[model samples]
Target: MEVILARPRGFCAGVNRAINVVNKALEVYQPPVYVLHEIVHNTHVIRELEEKGAVFVEQLEDIPKGSIAIFSAHGVSQAVKERANELGLRTINATCPLVSKVHRRVSLLNKINYDVVVIGHKGHPEVEGTCGHASGSVHVVSSPDEVQCLQVNTPSRVGYVTQTTLSIDDTAEMLKALRRRFPEISAPSRTDICFATSNRQTAVRELSKAVDLILVVGSKNSSNSNRLREVAQKNNIPAHLIDHAGEIERGWLDKARRIGITAGASAPEHLVTELVAWLRENYKVRTVREMDGVDETICFQLPPI
Candidate 1:
């Protein structure tokens, strides 16, 4: 058995920055640093941070007044910011710059009286945060079918932004439908899907051709992680999204000659290392190689603590 790892697979610039934000906060402040949501979606990352005294909370109200509250990399809505201020919490904005760009785009569109549309899964923290930026007509459409059912205030005056972690092909399909329905629709100058998400998916697309089965190491809730699995499945390759190696099913690997391994943006590289170790020990894997792909050099600056 052989294992092929995807290049640019784990810990993108934004995730790196976000994790550093939490770590820097821990260094500067006392224990119990409040985070609005999971700093990043990886289960292992969150567990480690929790061990270091980061408190993840769903609501701002749960945080004590005047305490330090750090926003997750997923970003937060304008209302969330206001509420945080109302509670007298010392807040640190750890939102990924790319996600913040989407917020600014939607906010500007709404200010200009354009009915905004967000291309993302409804109820996702990032999507909800992006939607919250728009006070006027805004809609969340996840599919090409949903685009047809959109009821914007003015169909002619619509603008759109997408979640940073969406599947590029899927987002393109939605964009096609949106353009057909609203001929004059406006869009950002650049694609909203972040560079890391695009690079990882492209790497997976390349991996699908070489491997019999793809194993994506990431938490189920990680959007970019899920997209990586989808990219493999779309290529007719069997794929599984697992948080770690323990979840791997022996039956799934029985017939595979070469296995592909990739981790999501938020997943730690050590998880991928452990996965390779497991395959080596149990499957008697003789070769482990990394596929040639993008060498991501981009790094986001960490927010001040």
Candidate 2:
């Protein structure tokens, strides 16, 4: 058996910055630093931060007044920011710059009287946050089919923004449908999907061709991680998404000559190493290598103290 790893697989710039924000807060401020949500979607990362005194909360009311609070990398809606101010919390904006860009774009579109449309899954924290940025008529659609059912106030003048974690091919298809339905609909100068998400998916697409089964290491709730698994499966390669090495099933290895491993943007590299170690111990793994792919150099600056 051979194991092939995907390049540019884990810890995007935004996730790195968000994790650092919590670490710095722990060092600079007192204990019980409040984080609005999971700093990133990985359970291991959250557990590690929790061990270091980070308190993760879903609502602002749960946090004590005047305490230090950091927003998640997923970003927050305008309402969340205002509520934080109303509660006298010392807030740090740890929203990923790319996600922040989408928020700003949607807000600008709403201000100019253009009916806004956000392409993302319903109830996702990022989707909710992006939608909260819009003040006027806004709609959220996850599929091209949903685009046809939209009842916009001004169909002729609509603008759209997308979640940063979505599959590029899926978003492109939805965008095409939106344009077909609303001839005057406008979109951002570039797609809203983050560079890290694109790079990871590209790497997976390349790796899928050389391996028999693909194992994606990430939490189930991770959107970008799910997309990576789907990208491989869409190419007719068998794939599985697991949180860690423990979730790996012996059945997945049956008849598989080569296994490919990839991690999501929020996943830690240590988990990948553990998976490889497990493979080496259980199977007669002859060769383990990383496939040639993009070397991501992008890094986001930490939030101001």
Candidate 3:
């Protein structure tokens, strides 16, 4: 069987920077390093870091006073930062700079007397953080249907931003619907979708069309990873979102002679290597054609340790 692997499929620069923040902090500060959330959404990465003395906590209250605490790359609400500060946790902001850019745009819009709308999943940490930027004006709408039903404080004066990780086509469709409904609506001068997300999805869209089945390696909670599977499924191709090779179902490959594989930004390369090796050893997989596409060198500097 032929397997097509997309180049630049895993570990985007933001994810790398976030993971490195935790790693470097642990190295410099020693054990008992506490992270406010999973540095990134990959299961293996979290397990590995946890083994190395990094403690993951969902709330600032769980961290000891006077200890260092990291905000995940997912970003956090203003309230979270305030609470962490109140608790005496030496806060390290590892939020992706791209995500922070969106926040800044929306903040500017709010400051200029515009009611803001956000295109993203409700309750996502990033969305919550973004909404916190404008509690008086910001609104969250996830779908075109929701946009149709949305009620803004003012009809003609509105702006919007989106989560860093969302399906590009889906968000475009929603944005189009919103624009159609509100002709005078204004949007950010820039796009909020991160570069890594756009590139990965673009690569996978092409990869999906060439293979009978596609595998997206990522945790279920990972928004970008889930969108990869949705992209493949939207093309009428069978797709699986799995954490590792063990999660792969042999039944899906019964009729497929070729498969495409890609991983989310938070996923590491080792899972991809292991999965491909498994297919090669047991499923007669051979002749991998590497589809190298985008070039990404984006990196964020960690806050001083």
Candidate 4:
């Protein structure tokens, strides 16, 4: 058996910055420092931080008044920030820069009297946060079918922004639907999908061609990670999104000679290391290799805690 790793897998610049902010808060603040949501989407990362005294909460009201609170990398609605202030919590914004850009774009659209359409899965923390930025009419649409059924107050005065972690191809199709319906709809100057997401999807597409089965190392709730699995499947290749090596069933490997491994932005590299080790010990895998792909050099600086 052989294992081929995807290049540019695992932690990206934004995830790195978000994780560091949590760690830095732990060092700088009192114990039980609160975080709004999973700092990233990986369970391992969240567990590690929880061990170090980070408290993850879904609602700001759960946090004690005047305590230190941190927002997740997915960003938060303006109302969330206001509520945090009402609670007298000293909050740190750990929102990824890319996500923050989307929020800003949405706010700008709302200011210009354009009804905003957020192209992402509904109920996602990022989507909720982005929607909060728009005090006016804002709608969430995930597919072309939703786009067909969408209704905006002013058809001519409409603008759109996407989740930073969406699939490039999927977003393109959604854009086509929006353009056909609202010919004068406005768009952001640059694409909202983050660079790390685009690179990982591109790498997985290339990796799928060389392997019999593909394993995406990421949590099930991770949007970008799920996209990776879909991208491989779109190529007629079997793909599984596993949180870690233990999730890999022995039977799933029985029919495959070549396996491809890739991790999501939030997943830790140690999980990937352990996964490869598991394959070697349990499956007697040999000839481990990493495919050539993008070398991500971009890094976001940690915000002052």
- For each candidate in turn, the TM-score is 0.99, 0.99, 0.97, 0.98
As for candidate 2, its clashing pairs are: none
Model 2 scores worst on lDDT over the 10 consecutive residues at 296-305
Question: Which segments of candidate 4 are over 4 A away from where they belong?
Answer: none
C-alpha RMSD by candidate, in order: 0.8, 0.8, 1.1, 0.9
Cα distance off (Å), candidate 4, residue 272: 0.6
The lDDT per prediction is 0.94, 0.94, 0.89, 0.93
Candidate 2 lDDT by residue in tens digits, 1-305: 99999998999999999999999999999689999989899999999999999999988999999899999999999999999999999999899999999999998998999999999999999999999898898899999999989998878889999999999899989989999999899889988999999999999999988999999999999999999999999999999999999998899999999999999999999999999999999989999999998888888888797
lDDT of 4 at 21: 95
For candidate 1, which ten residues in a row score worst on lDDT? Answer: 296-305
Q: Candidate 1, residues 232-263: lDDT per residue as tens digits?
A: 99999999999989999899999999999999
Residue pairs with clashing backbones, model 4 = none
Query: Model 3, 1-305: lDDT tens per residue?
Result: 99999766999888999999999999998988999888899999999999999999987899999998999998887888888889888988888888888878778888888889899999888898888777468889999999888887788888889999999999999899989988898887778998889899999888877899999999998999999999999888899999999998889999888899999999999999999999988888769888969888777788788
Model 1 residue 187 lDDT score: 82
Considering only N, C-alpha and C atoms within 3 Å, which residue pairs clash in candidate 3?
none
Residue 259 shift from truth in candidate 4, angstroms: 0.5
Candidate 3: deviation at residue 139, Å?
0.6
- Model 1 earns a TM-score of 0.99
